[model samples]
Target: MDLSELRVEIDKVDKQIVELFEKRMDIASQVADYKISTGKKVFDKEREDQKLRAVKELASSEFNKTGVEELFSHLMSMSRKLQYQKLASAGAAGNLPFIQIDSIDKASSRVCYQGAEGSYSEAAMKKYFGEEVNSFHVDTFRDAMAVLEDGSADYAVLPIENSTAGIVSEIYDLLTEYEHYIIGEEIIPIRHCLLGVPGTKLSDIKRVYSHPQSLMQSARFLSEHSHFEQISMKNNAFAARKVAQDKDKSQAAIASALAAKVYGLEILEEGINQADSNSTRFIIVTNRKVFLKDAHKVSICMEIPHEAGSLYHMMSHFIYNNLNMTKIESRPIEDKDWEYRFFIDFEGNLADSAVKNALRGLREEAKMLKILGNY
Candidate 1:
């Protein structure tokens, strides 16, 4: 359409949109009444899934699916909010207590972080909650999850992704398996600084330790420092601790400058990321869902049928639905050779009606689908 005609058409659409939105709001109020009478909860997974499937089955083309899902996801999210407002007004889930990491006393609220004291995940937790938060150390990701489950810690900090390495499939898979919610995220620059005890010269160092990604970033430096043998550790921070504890000034670690300071080690070298902008994304997970004021991202994991154009056709659902995808990653499905599970992180809250509808359609079309979490 021409610019003038497009403007006029958009105006007309806007008018219709406002009208439909009002109508949706009215129906949402009615839904609140029905739910109250039936003693039903605000979120219904099965009902929500069934609703989306019905929409997809009725959709004829990708374009329609895109537009409708986008429109409906927002609509549904708003509708649910309105319904919640009504329920709250009637005194349901009233005066619930919410914890803010900042407000919580660092000395009181204990936390679990993966790896020993010098780990990147620990750095992330300290960044998010400050050093005052007494941290329980863990050896592995599952151990961190276990701490939260066993009530040993109120929350857990763990790395989700790295800029170079992309998505950490292990974290996403564990998200589904663990009883926790990703309440917040932190991005920490991955500076693989060379660390050792103070007064150690570069020539004195004999060994270096770091994670695979860290080792990869510092490959050039390692190659140049022929005297030092590179040792692979589970993580950068752990390497720092190992190097700090080692009595030999000849041994060092490749970790962030922060880790070196935390572990009482000295930086032998700095700026190790092949790209200076290296960063790792970490998440703050808790035992319960977070009542996020403005949900900035939505995370979903789904599966597509083993048919021609299945992936392409399903992705169109996101496109047609008008959701801006931030990330997409695929993992192999166990016992289902060649079959994969996909994780998609996108803009907009899942509470929106259009997103809900689009997802409903997607679930219907795909062999398997799951909303990993929405935060």
Candidate 2:
């Protein structure tokens, strides 16, 4: 066929594809109507998962695999929207938990975060609470908690873990030290970038600066260059500012890409984290106890007697109650010389009967036990 004829045919196919999508959406609307009549959810994750798996399996071209998965994921999101809209029109989806409306007021809320602006924790706070937050700065996690304890702040943000680093031990220790609850959680995407003073050249870098966590994340890129001395700062943003103010062109900072942009520092390198999937999980702590949403994580600490099967017995208690323990860590009791304290994060909430039963059993079998927070 001639090029003109072929182009016309391609345009015709594109038009047909658009029409087919509209028809599919119309069918989805009908399904939503039926679901509303029967009291059913607008979104079914299992069905969406199955459809995505089938579509991905049919993606024959290696180069198009990611494109196809992304395309379908977007389509599934749209499907949920169309379904919910239809159900909402019928007064069904409007009553569902997933269909949310209105933003909560944070105008008077004081948000406490480690470091100044451009820090990951600060970014996390804004992401969770937006500009409505009156953000306060803290030099350390302990200081942030102290702010909340003193009623200087309404909320304190702390990074609990990273996909690459596993866990932040200091943050976990602080969680046990303070009386607070994890009211909410956010996962920040971590992208370590090398930042230097505006006029600084790569050749002029004699020293690198960053928080220990940032340095650890960018170890690979920093380790290869032996000429640069790595200096650890208390926070990532503080390091960025130090580099920005430093007269030495050889001085650079390892921090978030956002931080480099904020400080007007040149990015020597980007995506310096150990893994592409690296993310830091932050929890919002509030001194005032709040009833957690049904889907929430509960953290508790308990001490088991120093006996042969005492630890084993605790494990059995969790098993008997059919509770999944997300995390379990033991630290030496600060002043007790050799005794140990256990910190655990479990799947169920304090309101769950099974969780309560397991805790009761643990308390009966052990010496000291505490339900840190329900959230």
Candidate 3:
């Protein structure tokens, strides 16, 4: 046959395929109705797997077999999504484990932050809750979480990630360890400075102190002065306080200008960080599982089975539902050799239909899934 004849035949097949798709979807709707009445789940992995194997075997060539598998996978996903939509409409979809609130009360709420008075977490808390909001300080990030768990504070502000240095691993692990829920987040512009007591000069500094992240962020500056000893403290503010109290002309700190001011120290060198636009993202966590009604972002962590295409199949749910995933990070699971947990940040609220469908699929496919937050 000529090329024109082949093209015509392909178009005719496409039309027939469209008609079959519609008919299949109509039958899927009936299945959804039966499932709803019987309180049955939307997804059945074994059944879908059997159907995919059967469809792939129908193809004569290996290439066509792969194509058929892909095609049926998508069709099955669509049918399952339609069933989920129907279940949601019928009020049969399971309830999410979070409570939606109109807003957080920042006016009278007590806030806690890791580090001393002038750390970035403190600045984030101030920016989120305002200056007049009652706040306290803790020596470590765990201490901050402890305050929240013990009902000593309404919210705890802790650094989750930095633009230059990547995620705060300790905080991520703590998120899994603790029951606190992240209700909000704030980003603070970081300006690492070399702070010292008044009349101290950069030439006289022999040792520098700050948080480990601050030290890494200022790695370029610290490398230039290899003669100086670098000491990692619990926080930059605590380092600044140590320098101010010690009255040592040979000791300096890499901390925020706010820390310098709070500790009555001078900025001997400004903008010491490697990147000028460096910033840190901090999360506002609370003991109660509550989220604001207008939250537009969601964070989740999941562990998928160790099988070929498992991760791909899990992510396909988000793509099929048109959910935009913003960030994904993997961390090694403690004591589980060669296994990891993936933390994902996606742009959608729990109240969204597409988000609901995606979460439903993820929960079904992944070995474990946890909704970290909706904010």
Candidate 4:
């Protein structure tokens, strides 16, 4: 056949495919209605696997076999989405476990933050809850979680990410380990300074101390002073306090300007970090599973089946529902070799239909699923 004739054949096949697709969707809606009355699940993994294998067997070529499997996988996924929509319209979709509130009662809430005074966590807490906010400090993130668990504090403020150094991994682990939920978040600009005892000069410094991440952030400046030994402390504020207590002119701390004032130390150098726009993101966590009514961001974590295209198929839920995913991170699962848990942050409220649809699909397919929060 000539080129035009071949093109005409392809168009004819495409038209038939579209019409068949529409017919399949109509049947899927009927299936949805049946399941709604019967209370059956939308996703059937064993049935999907069987169908995929059957389709792949019909393909005569190896490459075509793989393509056929992929094509059917998408078709099944689309059908499931349609079924979920039908289920939702029938009021069969289950309600989420989270409660909604107009706003967090900050004035009456007692907050807890990790690290001592003048640390970045404190700054973020003060920024979010006002300077006069009732707050206390703990030595570790776990301790902060413990306080929330025992009802010692109403909210806990903890840093989850840094713009320059990346995420605070412990915070992620703690979130999964504890039953706390993130109610809000605050971003604080980090301005690291080289602080020393009063009247101390740069040349007199023989040792530098700060949190490991703070030391890393100021690596460029610390490298120039190679003669000084770097020591890691629990927090930057602790380092400043130690330097002040020891009255050691030979020791300096890389911390915030607030640390210098709280410890009564002088700032020998300011803006020591490499990045001028360095900042840290802090999350406000509470023991209750409640979120603000106007919250627009949802955080969830899940573990997918250990198989090819599993992750891709899982992500298609977001694409199918048109949800905007903002960030995704993976953490190694404890005691599960070669397996990881995925944490995803997306723009959607828990009350939205699209969010419900996506969550329903994910809950049915994923090995495990947990909604971290909505804020």
Candidate 5:
């Protein structure tokens, strides 16, 4: 056939495909109605597997067989999403585990934070709760989670991510381990300062101490003074406390200006961190499964089967429901080799129908799913 003739033939086939697609969706809607009436689940893995195999066998070529399977998978995914939306509209979507509160009562609540008095976590807590907020400190992030789990603290502030250094991985694992939920987040700009005892100078410093992340963040400044030995401490405040107690001009700490004031030290240098806009995100967590009424962000974690296209299919739930996913992070499962859990942050309130539909679809398809929080 001539080029124009061949193009005409292809256009005709495309038109037919579009008509067939709409017809198929109409049938899918009928199926959704039937399932809604009969209380039957929308997704049937066995039936889908059988149908895919049957369609693949009818394909004339291997490449066509793979393409057909992919095409059908998407069609089935869309059908499932449609059914979920219908179910949500009918008020069949299950209730989320969290309770909605008007607001967090920060004034009367007792809060806890990781690190010592002058650490960034403490600063975040003060920023979130207020300067006069009643709060205590823990030695580690896990200890902070423990306090929340034990009901000793109404809220716990722990760092989850640093713009310069990346995520605080331990916090992710602890979120999975404990029943606590994040109700809010606070971001604090980091300004690493070189702190030392009175009369201490850059020339007098021989060894420096701070959290490992702080040391890494201040590498640019520390590298210039190669004579100073870098030592890792549990927290920057603890490092400052150590330098203050020792009263040694040779010992210095890379910490916050707050640490210098709290520990009676002097700031030898300021803004030592590599990035001027460096900041850390801290999550305020509570033992109760509650979210603020105006919360706009939802966090969830799920484990999908370690199979090809598993993650893609799970993500399709978000796409089909029009949820704007902001971030996704994966962490290795502790005892499961080659398997990982995904943590997703998306912009949506729990009360929205789209959010309900997406969560319902995910709960059905994912191996395990947990709503971390809405904040």
Candidate 6:
């Protein structure tokens, strides 16, 4: 046959395929009704595996076999989603563990942040909870989390990521270790400055101090002055305080202007960070597992089997449900060789139908899954 005739034949086959797809979906709806009446679950992994193998066997060539398997996987996922929607409509969807609240009571809340008074985390806390909030400072991020868990503080502000330095891995691990829920998030613009004690000049400085992340963010500035010895401190504000207390003209720190003001230091240089749009995202975490009713973002962690196509199969749930994944990060599992845990942020609330459907599939397919927060 000619090329036009062959293309026409393909179109005819596609039309037939669409008709069959509609018919199959109708039957799947009836199946959903039967399962709902009998209180049966929506997912049957063994059945799905068997069907996939059966469909592959119907293909003539090796390439066609793989294609057929992929095609059927998507079809089955669609059918499962339809059933999930029906289940949700019938109020049979499983309950979420988080309690929904109208809003966070920041006015009366006691907040905690890591580092000294002039740190970026303190700035984020002030921005999120306002300046009048009863706030205190802790030495480390773990200490801040401990205060929140022990009821010493109603909320804790912790940095999660930076636009230039990437994610704060320690904070992610702390979230897994501590039982805290992220109720809100705030982003603070970073404006790094070179701070030194009074009468200290740029040429008089020999040693510079700052947080490890700050040092990294100010790499260009540090590299330009290779003669200056770099020292990493627990926090930028702590570095500034140390420089002030030492009263050494040779010692300086890379910190914010607030730190300079708090510690009585001069800003020798401003905007030292390489990126002009540097900013850090901080999470507002509380011990209670509650989310605001208007929450529109969800964070989750899951572990998938270390096997071929396992990750792809797991991600298909989000794709099939039309969930827009905002970010994904992977961390190595402790003591588990070659295994990792995945953290995902998606644009949806736990109360959403699409989110419910995606979570249902993830719970069944993933080796382990946890809802980190909804905010």
All candidates: TM-score: 0.70, 0.69, 0.91, 0.98, 0.98, 0.94
- The Cα error of candidate 3 at residue 110, in Å, is 2.6
> How far is each candidate from the true structure, as Cα RMSD in Å?
7.9, 17.7, 2.2, 1.1, 1.1, 1.8
Candidate 1 per-residue lDDT, tens place, 1-375, comes to: 899999999999999989988987898899889987786766564776577667766779988876666556556655655565566557553332333232334467789888776677878898988878787788888898888888889888888898887777788888777767776788988777888898999989888888877888888888888888888998788888887777589888888777877889887778866777778999888886543656667677888867545686567656756788888888888889999888888876655655664565566557777665555
The superposed Cα distance between candidate 1 and the true structure at residue 193, in angstroms, equals 1.0
Model 4: per-residue Cα lDDT over 20-95, one tens digit each: 9999999999999999999999899999999999999999999999999999998998999899888888888789
Task: Give me the candidate number with maximum lDDT.
Answer: 4
lDDT ranking, high to low:
4, 5, 6, 3, 2, 1
The better candidate by lDDT, 2 or 3, is 3
lDDT of 1: 0.75
Candidate 3, 1-375: lDDT as tens digits? 999999999999999999999999999999999999998887888998899999999999999999999889879877887887788778776778889899998999999998898888888999999999899998888898899999999999999999988999988888888888888999999999999999998899999998888898899999999999999997899999999999999999999998988899999999999898899999999999888889999999999988666787788878878999999999999999999999999999888878887887788778999888998
Stretches off by above 4 angstroms in model 3 are none
RMSD of 3: 2.2
Query: What is the C-alpha local distance difference test score of each model?
Result: 0.75, 0.75, 0.90, 0.94, 0.92, 0.91
Worst 10 residues of 4 by lDDT: 84-93
In model 6, the runs with Cα more than 4 Å from the true position are none
Which has the higher lDDT value, candidate number 1 or candidate number 6?
Answer: 6
lDDT of 5 by residue, 1-375 (tens): 999999999999999999998898889989888988999998898899999999999999999999999999888888888888888888889898879899988899999998897888888999999999999998888898888878889999989999989999999999999988999999999999999998887999999999999999998898999999999999999999999999999999999999999989999999999898999999999999998989999999999978878899999888988889999999999999989999999999998889988999999999999999999
For residue 270, model 5's alpha carbon misses the true position, in angstroms, by 0.7
Candidate 5: TM-score? 0.98
Clashing pairs in 4: none
Q: Which stretches of candidate 5 lie over 4 Å from their true place?
A: none
How far out, in Å, is residue 351 in model 6? 2.7
For candidate 5, the lDDT comes to: 0.92
